[model samples]
Target: MNPNDRSIVALVMTGHGLVHTYELSIPIFMTAWLGELGVSEAALGAVVGAGYFLFGAGALPGGVLVDRFGSRRLIAGCFVGMGGAFVLLGLLPGLWGLGAALLAWGAAASVYHPAGLALISTGVQQRGRALAYHGIAGNVGIAGGPLATALLLLAFDWPTVAVLLGLPALLAAVGAWRTSFDERAAVGVHDAPDAGHGEPSPRPDDRAALWTRSKALFASGFAGVFVLVALSGLYYRGMLTFLPDLLTPLVTVDLPIDVAAGRYVYAGLLAVGIAGQYVGGRLSDHARTEWALAGALAVLAAVAVVFLPVAGVGTAALLAVSAVLGFFLFLVQPLYQATVAEYTPPEARGLSYGYTYLAIFGVGAAGAAGAGGLLQIAGPPLLFGALAGLALLGASLSGGLAVRRARVGTHP
Candidate 1:
């Protein structure tokens, strides 16, 4: 790859890492908030769910903004907003304040996926490899964020840790502002027709154009992919939201050394996703993305079905099972991302990603509340079973999409 490609990948990966760092760290803080604020787990989950809902909800508009303004501008703004929100989180001193801070952070963080992934799809040459590297960076943040937050909790309080965590966003904002890239080259369109150069330009009608594009996308069978992603989102959020709490009871063996056992195990499980992302990304490049997605979801369904019983055996067995679960959990990400790109036109890539994330994150945010409710009422077995069902549903949708694509003999 060229130097420009490398730079683009690096910038997008950095933003991806920062976004997940803030996102995944929230769960670690949730445990602290429960004790300090004296709130029920359900109440705390509601607050977190609100933030996640905003995160997903904002993505479609954020994509529109990225398409209009350019990805670099939106990404830089995201970092600034996220950083400021975290600073407020540190300074504020009440549950209400915390809720406000999280809401603000979610709004800010929502821009990253649409902007970063759109940037990658447009700017990079080795799209698959770039996406693989991007997934790796995200998994790194997923694993490291919790581990770092857990270690920080051992020393400093949650507020102080939050303040420290906000620092990277500040740094990343500066990096984004200073870095230069050609948006026209990436998207293969000029922002405006060159009036000075006597170029013929059509009168702009933003709303009509956006609606027309969206209508075409849905009519072209993007709806099936959207449903598949939504199901994936539901399963992803439902299983992950309570994983740490779920695992707490299953660990029966003592560690060789003293550690925050739940946190350590949580981090280890997510760390394994890095390898999964690498494999998934690689496969998406070489194999059919829909087929890859269908296969991954099938395995994920099987894993979720067996998770409860295997988790009961012993610490080693539980950890091993958790590792397998983690592998399939993240492996579907790149496949779906690549599939979205395949199904959409180049000009509308940003908007396509916007709707994709809306399904994955916005509609998917219900998983947190749903999982929390199940844990409180039905318990782990039912929860795992529900997740397995969701995965199967997602796999069925993906398989249908694959069949449709084969029948049409074109990318859908």
Candidate 2:
């Protein structure tokens, strides 16, 4: 790819990083936020759920807009909108205010996937690597969100933390507006114009469009892949959402170890996710995506096993297991995302990406809520066990895709 292409990907990916860093703070600092608002766990889940619902709802429309115009404009708009939402979130007074701000942020966040993925498909020769970079950048942003909030909460309040987080999004938004992506190269190679609206109206075959997508998905082994991706999203988000609570027990150990030790220990586990992101990216290039996903899930399985069996394990073992789980858990994200790209048609790639995110965040948000309920009912063993079972299901789903691909004699 040309320098311009690299520049575009870097900018878009960085914008995504900023958005996640700012917008995802609530979940990262949920304990503090809930304390400040005096809300129940279930209520917190509902608020977060509303954010995710809007996030998914906006995607399909975002896809249509990206396809109609181009990824560049949509990305620029998304960044600015997200930045505004963060600022609003910071300024919000209570639960109602927070919910409104998150809804706005989620709507803005929706634009990124379709626009960014469309840009990747348009600009890069090695689409998988490009997506991996983007995914890793977002992971870095995710890790940063919590770390930043944790540090800020030590000195300032959640409101102050929210305001500070908005700064990155504001700056990134400005940078996005100034940058120009290679639109011609970025998309339009294979994307079909919407016959419903675009000029020189083509044959309107909504039924054919549906069938075409279905056939492509089946031919590409995406039907089974979707189950794995969906299950992976469920387990991944569920684990991450409650990670702090899970670490609470570990941190509260009555040992005379340092007070700061627990905080650092927990942060260290999350920081290790960076390695997982890199490993997953590289592994996807060499191994078939299914195998790569399976490998990651296998690691998650082992982590769950070690974590569940070892009672009162020391900080070292906790850190080790947490890091290992973080590694494998996050590693699967990019690979699964790349599979979505590989499976989609060029014309509807934006829509395909939108649908993928819809499935991920939409379904995953529900999973997060369900996880809290599961924890309430059965406790951590059942919670982690259920997570493990989901990962295993994802592995089996991927295996089915492999079998289907063998029968079809090729992978799309």
Candidate 3:
């Protein structure tokens, strides 16, 4: 990336990583919540699901804010909000506390995707490479969060660790406010804010205009992508919500120093996902995004279908399956992100991403509660089966999207 694009990616990278750091940390904390608070997995999952739902649901308005204001302000606000939410977690330390903290974090975090993706898509010249880097940073946080939380728990208590986790974002808030970059560097002259003579950017503040903008957005074949995103989100949420706890039993074996076996494995799985994200992002720039994403989802479905059988095998086989699952789980993200860019115009990128994440984390967050209930009633086998079904549906939608675009000669 050139200097300007580097700056934009850096800002989004930092903010994105921190967001997932707090996000994935919740499950690690869930282990402690289960031990200390005496809450059932089903109840815990539901509460956590509520927060994640808001995280996605808030993206719609956040997209509007991104278009109206710009990414920088919203991101700085996100940093402050997430930091404050974690601080609340430290202070409260109860079931109700978890719910409240998560909701706060969700609201604060809701703007990030719209803000970050809009910034990158519009501001950065090299959108694909920038997204790859962004996805890698997120995987870092996704892996790092659980690993850090697990390690910290070995020394300090959960509350102290929570506060410590909160501090970094507080510091980042200052960095965000101080950082400098352009919001429309890559935009055409017509889309540039300072353009003297061109089509003015849409201000969808009025109800009729807002409705028109939204209607045109989904009608642009983004609706197919939305279905895929919702399925992907559902599978992601359901699979990860109780995965560490679920894997804890299967992965139990001798280790030098004591550790949460499942947490470390989960972290390792996500660490492996870093490569997946990279591959997906690079492929998005070259391959057909819909087709590539469909292949990834198919592989993901196979992994989910065989996950339980793999778990029954030796530890090595279980770990191998986990590594593959994690890889494909995240691999589709950048592809879908790129797909969104293909379907939407630059002027509407914010709203497009808003709806995108809303599908992924908001509506899809039901997977958490659904997984918990399934785990309680049937077990891992049935839960994995349902997850496989979600992946299959996503794969079909993505393939259908590819076929439709090809037939219409819009496969760019």
Candidate 4:
């Protein structure tokens, strides 16, 4: 990669990692929240879901902001918002306080996926490999965030950890300010009439024009892509939210004797996701992204169906299920990301990704509450079954998208 491409990816990758670091870290802290806050799983789940819901729900406007302003500026703003939110989390440290901080975080983090992914889709030359590397960075944060939180809990309290975690976001904001790169270096201004000079063409002023843009985008098979991502998100959030708690009982082998075993297993699952993202991103470059997405979703469905059964056999069995769960879980991300790039117009890419996350994180936020309630009442088998059902639905949708792409030809 040239210096500019490297710089752009580095900025985005770091920012992406930090976003998820804070994201995944919340679940780890939730473990403490259970006892500290004196809330039932169902109640805490709703609270967590509310925060995540806002995080996703805000992406629509955030995408508009990205198009109106620039990704760099919005990304900087995201860092500030997230950092400040975490600091607030440190101060409040109550159930209501947690919800408020997460709401702030959701609003802040909602800016990232659209801004960062739009930058990559527009800026990078080697889009596929760049996405692969970018996804790896995210996996690092996803895996490391909880691990870091778990490790810190061994020493400091959750409140202090929340404050310490905020530091990285502030640092990333500094990096964003210092970093320099051409945002539209790869795709160029000519390819995007409204999208050159590091700014999008002015957004449509009237509802009719806005509707026209949305209609055109969905007509291009992005509708399928959107639904696919939502399904994937449902499974993603449902599986991840309570995974540490769920695995706590299954852990038999001895560890550091200080930390909760489930937290490490959770981190390890995310660690394996690094490879999953690499392989998925690489595959997207070589084959139709939708096709690869279908296959991955299929594997996920199988794993979800078998997860509880496989996990119950022994510690080894549990670890085995966890590893597969981790790998294919993240593999879906880049595939859907690449598909969004292929299926949407470059000028409205921000809006496109906005809807994507709206589906994934917003609608998918329901999974947190759903998983929690189900786990409390119906237990793991039912929870895993519900997850498997969602994955199967996603796989079917992806398969349809793959077939649609085969018949219709690639999007412009």
Candidate 5:
């Protein structure tokens, strides 16, 4: 890719990363918010879960807008919407107000997957690596959200902290407004002998082509991939949402120390996954895509077996297992996302990514709610067991997809 392409990728990534940090502030500051608002635990959980559900629900329509309008405009709108949502949340009064604010946040957050992924697909030539960098930016944002919330909460109340979260989105909105990219614009409609350089053609009647290719892939093995990704999403949300809660009690340290230390430890572990994303990206750029995904799944399976059994595992051991788990789990995200990019035509990139992320966010929402219920009943052992089972099934499903993808390549 040239300097201009690189510059565009960076801008899109910055916007995406900033958007995530703002969207996630609610979960990061949930405890503090609940204390200030005097809400019950169950109510807080429900509200947070609703935010995730709304975020997923909005993705399909967000994709439609991305397809109709352009990534740049959609992304710019997302930034403004998310910033406005956070500002609303900061100024709102009660639990009802919180719910309304989260609804807006979810709707705004939904714009990222379609807009950001479409930007990378259209603006960059080697999309695999570009997508990986995008994933890295997201993970970095994920890590930063809690860290920022933690720091801000110390100085300001939940409302002020929320208002502060809006700053990044406001800045990103400005940046996104200035950029432009259109897949059809870059590659014109031209009929010629195979451009032996091996690039997917820009489809004529772009929207119709998008529908055709996306529908075909959905009917083919793509459905199976969606199931695997949904399960992967559930496992991730279940594990991350509950892991610290589960581990904190087992720690012999003070409450403040345990929560504080655990948060950073988990964030550090998650940071390792950035490497995983980059590795998957580089491998997908050249190798069969499934290999990178399979590697991640296999590692996650092994991590589950070792880490899930012991409830009171020491800090050092927890750190080690968490790092490996994070590496495998968070890393597979880009690989799955890139699969949508590689399989569909460029015109459908936005819709394909939209549906993929919809599955991810939807499953994650269910996992978040169901995990809370399960934790109450069977405790962490059963919960981890169930998640591990889901991971195992996802692995089997991914293996099947890989074999089928290989066969299609050989015969075609």
Candidate 6:
């Protein structure tokens, strides 16, 4: 890549890492919040679910903003807003206050995927490689965030930990603000004649244009991909929300030193996803993304089915299974992201990612509620079974997509 591309990728990757660091770190605090705030599991789930809902539901608007305002501005704003929200979270005194902070955080976070992915899809030369690196950065954040939060909890209170966690984002915000890059130059779309002329282009009204795009996308089988993404999100969010809590009792590690076994195990599980993301991203560039997605979903289904049984075996077995599960879980992300790019036009990539994330994080927010409910009533077996079912559903949809693509002789 050129120096300019490298700079943009680095900046975006840094932002991506911080976004997820804040996101995944929240789960580590759930147990602490239960005791400190004196809330039921269901209520806590509802609160987190609300933030997650906005994280997704807000993406459409966020995408529009990205398309209008430019990706760099939105990404920089996300850093500031997310950091400020975390600072507020540290100072908040009640459940309602925490909820408000999370709401702010979610709103800020909602802008990231659309902006970042749009920047990458438009700016980067080797889209798949850039996406793989991007996924690796995010997985690093996922792996480190909870682990760091857990380790911090051992020394400082959750509030102080939240404050500390907000620091990196603030710094990233500064970095992003100072970094210079031309989105039009990187994407090369603005170089066309009349690109920046003060004359209006021969396009429909904004709403009409969006509607037309949406209809076209739906008619062209993007709807099926959207369904596959939503199901994947359901499985991803549902299984991950309470993975530490679920695995705590089942894992029996005999470490010599004092440590939060469950938290570390969770970290280890997510860390393995770095490899998964790399593999998935590379494979998406070479093979059919739908087929790759189907394979990953199949692995996820098998992992979900065997998760509980493996947990019963021993700590080693449980950790191994968790690692595998985490790998397949995150492996789907880059594949689906690449698939979305394949299915959309460069000019509308922001909007496409906006809808994609809405499915992934918005509808996917229900997974947390579903997991909490299942845990409350049916237990781990049913929860894992439900996850397995979701994965199977995704795999079936992906298989169907593959068939459809074959018949149409189109990559999307």
Q: Every model's Cα RMSD, please?
A: 5.2, 5.2, 4.0, 3.6, 4.5, 4.4
Cα-based TM-score, every candidate = 0.86, 0.81, 0.88, 0.87, 0.80, 0.88
What TM-score does prediction 5 earn? Answer: 0.80
Distance (Å) between predicted and true CA of 293, model 1?
2.4
lDDT of 5: 0.68
- Those runs of model 5 whose alpha carbons end farther than 4 Å from true positions after fitting are 1-10, 33-43, 120-136, 174-214, 253-260, 282-295, 305-311, 338-350, 403-412
User: Candidate 5, clashing residue pairs?
Assistant: none
Could you tell me the TM-score of candidate 2?
A: 0.81
Model 5: per-residue Cα lDDT over 1-412, one tens digit each: 6665676677777876876676555555665554467765556666777878778878767766776787778788888888888888888888888889888888888877766765665566666666557756777787777667767766777788888888778877887777554444333322331211122323324667667776776875567777877888788776766554455445455554324344455556566777776676566677666666766777676676668544356666676677778777767876786665655545444445556777888667777776666766776667777777878887787777778877788321
lDDT of 1 by residue, 143-248 (tens): 8988898888888888999999898898889998999876434444334322110111121248788788788778866778888899999998888777776676
- TM-score of structure candidate 3: 0.88
Residues 1-412, model 4: lDDT tens digits: 8888898889889888988998898888877787688887788788889889988998767767877788898999999999989988988857888888888998899888768877876787766667667766877788888899999988888889889989889888988988888887876633443321122333566578878888887887788888889999989999898888788778877775756678878888888888887787688779887778888999999998888778888889998889988889988887888888787777776567667778989999999999889887878899999998999999898888778777877653
Tens digit of lDDT per residue, candidate 3, span 1-412? 7898999999989988999998888888777777788988788889999999999898778867887889899999999999999989989967998889989999999888778877876788877688768866887888898899888988987888888999999899999999899888988722343211011234477778878998998777877888888999999999988888878778746888765688888888888888887788789879999899999999999999999888878679889999999889888888888888788776776566667778999988899989878887888888999999999999999998889889999743
- Once superposed on the true structure, which residue ranges of model 1 sit more than 4 Å away at CA? 1-10, 117-135, 175-205, 255-260, 345-347, 407-412
Compare the candidates by lDDT and give the number of the best one: 3
Residue 316 error for model 5, in Å? 1.0
Q: How accurate locally, in lDDT, is each candidate? A: 0.79, 0.67, 0.84, 0.82, 0.68, 0.80
Question: Going through the candidates in order, what is the number of backbone clashes in each?
Answer: 0, 3, 0, 2, 0, 0
Q: Which pairs in model 2 have colliding backbones?
A: 122-186, 191-347, 192-347
**Model 5 per-residue lDDT at 147:** 69
Cand. 6 TM to true fold: 0.88
Off by over 4 Å in 3: 1-10, 67-70, 119-133, 178-203, 345-347
